[model samples]
Target chain A: MTDVRVIEIKKSVFADNNEDAARLRSELKGRGTYLLNLMSSPGSGKTTTLIQLINRIKDKIKVAVMEADIDSDVDAIKIKDATGIESIQLHTGGMCHLDAEMTRQGLDNVSLDGTDLVILENVGNLVCPAEFDTGAVRNAMILSVPEGHDKPLKYPLMFSVCDLVIVNKIDVMPYFDFDLDKCSEYVHMRNPKARIIPICAKTGEGVDAVADWLLEEVYNWKH
Target chain B: MHELGIVFYIIRDVKQAAQENGVEHVNAVVMNIGEVSTIVPEYLTDCWRWAADKEEMLKGCELKINIIPAVTTCGDCGREYETVKYGKTCPHCNSANTWLLKGNEVEIKEIEV
Candidate 1:
């Protein structure tokens, strides 16, 4: 009979990834690159918001975009066509989230020589993506008006982890019965320090605030 | 939802541990999954079965889970309560300043060889 030897290895599954994320953050800091990990559900207008926000801030800052999806280059091509900036597509090969290692690999494909900021459009998943840190300087998420205000209470982890929350498609708020005040309150309940910005990407309303926020973050990262 | 991805992480860690210990095969991998850690044990084990069998060292390796009950501590009244029942708010003082003390773990507790 073979004896079973138990070996204690008490470590969180995310421990190694957290360490990698930290290392990647410091590396990006040294190179004067600010990475923003943007997460949301599918059809949350993440791409549209990015296009609006990117066009607003492109001239002010040297920017790049990395679009990560299960499979497709549509977002990558869209960003490039709209903003004419360096945008790359990263296929997760069926994975629902991007970890630090995957983010590093995507960054390798990007030209970071003079890039000030790299916006990573993460897979449109509110659940899995929140569990993995992608070595970004800050984390942000978009919650469209149609998704309801209760998302924060449901996906607490996602809301808690993000530094900023953008409430998109606010132009249709009147038709959808989406309460901006209640959404703010719920978001604050999940994350006290999270900054909430309401925007209508289609009309370019409230997008300047997001662009200004990014510019300020990039400036802070530099000096 | 991402149990398969987590299974891959577990495999990577277990393989590393096995390599470090000079073990030929791992008999089982014990995990401490918190009640609120958001991982479904059934899905994790199911994914493990599919992914582990592909690895020579972890073939037929059992994945055992130890559920850790989620607890929350209220800052306003200094009371502890079950996280799953009450969530972020404190039941005693009805304070919203409560924080999770434990039960968010998704840890590899040990490996049996």
Candidate 2:
């Protein structure tokens, strides 16, 4: 005779991810490697901003880029071709977002020794990416002017959890009906502690400020 | 979009639990899904149905989702309200000093055998 019984197991789906994230955070902290998880909507100029930032600070700090996408290595190719920096392409196998375990696996695949700053462009998503903590020291998000000012209201959790919010495409601000002040206001309403920086990736405008902020954080993470 | 991946995780965990408890087959898996979570419940079940059937223990197993309402608390007024309605600003006191109290969960609450 076959035995049948009811088993009650109460466990969180994210519990494993959270535990892995904490361990990764401690490991990165001990290694003095600062991980920045950058997120944004598609075509928000994340790659351009990363290229510009890498070009500006490559001489001072050791930088590595991890390009995560559902498929394709196009972003990784662009990063290597544009800046000649050490870059790794992580394919999530059709997953829209990368969790902590996935981040740890990607880190293991790459070389982080003597790497001061490791930037992960997290799947170019505003929703799923924000929901999972990837053991990053800082969560940075970009909101392009073309994406409009009401995005914070529409996607509150994404703006709320980010430590830094960058408003890109300021050079075309005149073309688009994007109000920088209004957008900043909405972001502040959602997360009062989030720092907002306005920049244009194509013109290389206001990128220095971002580099400066990053340098400060990396220095702090090390010391 | 990543619902299929999540289903994989669920299958792995459930299989482990069933093995530990000497369960031959799982009847149902109840998940606690928060209202504001990024996971779409319908997509999750669809993925579960397809993926769960592949495993021997989880074949014909049901996936039940319990949607939890999102709530926000006003820092100034000490009042709780629906997060989906008013967002960060508190409608009671009109204060922006509000924070989410709950409703970001993606957890497995129960497993039936």
RMSD of each: 0.7, 2.0
lDDT of each: 0.96, 0.90
True contacts kept of each: 0.88, 0.76
RMSD value for candidate 2:
2.0
Q: Judged by DockQ cut-offs, is candidate 1 incorrect, acceptable, medium or high?
A: high
TM-score of each: 0.99, 0.95
lDDT tens readout by residue for model 1, A7-63: 999989999999999999999999999999999999999999999999999898899
lDDT of 1 by residue, B1-113 (tens): 89999999999999999999999999999999999999999999999999999999999999999999999999999989999999998989999998999999999999999
Best by TM-score: 1
Would you list the clashing residue pairs of candidate 1? none
Candidate 2 residue pairs that clash: none
Per-residue lDDT over A1-223 for candidate 2, one digit per residue giving the tens place of the 0 to 100 score: 5554656667877677778888999999999999999999999999999999999999999999999998999999999999999999999887889999899989987789999999999998788887678999999999999999999998888998899999999988888899988998999998888999999999999999999999999999999
Quickly count the clashes in candidate 1. Answer: 0
In model 2, state the lDDT of residue A80: 95
TM-score of model number 2: 0.95
**Which segments of candidate 1 are over 4 A away from where they belong?**
none
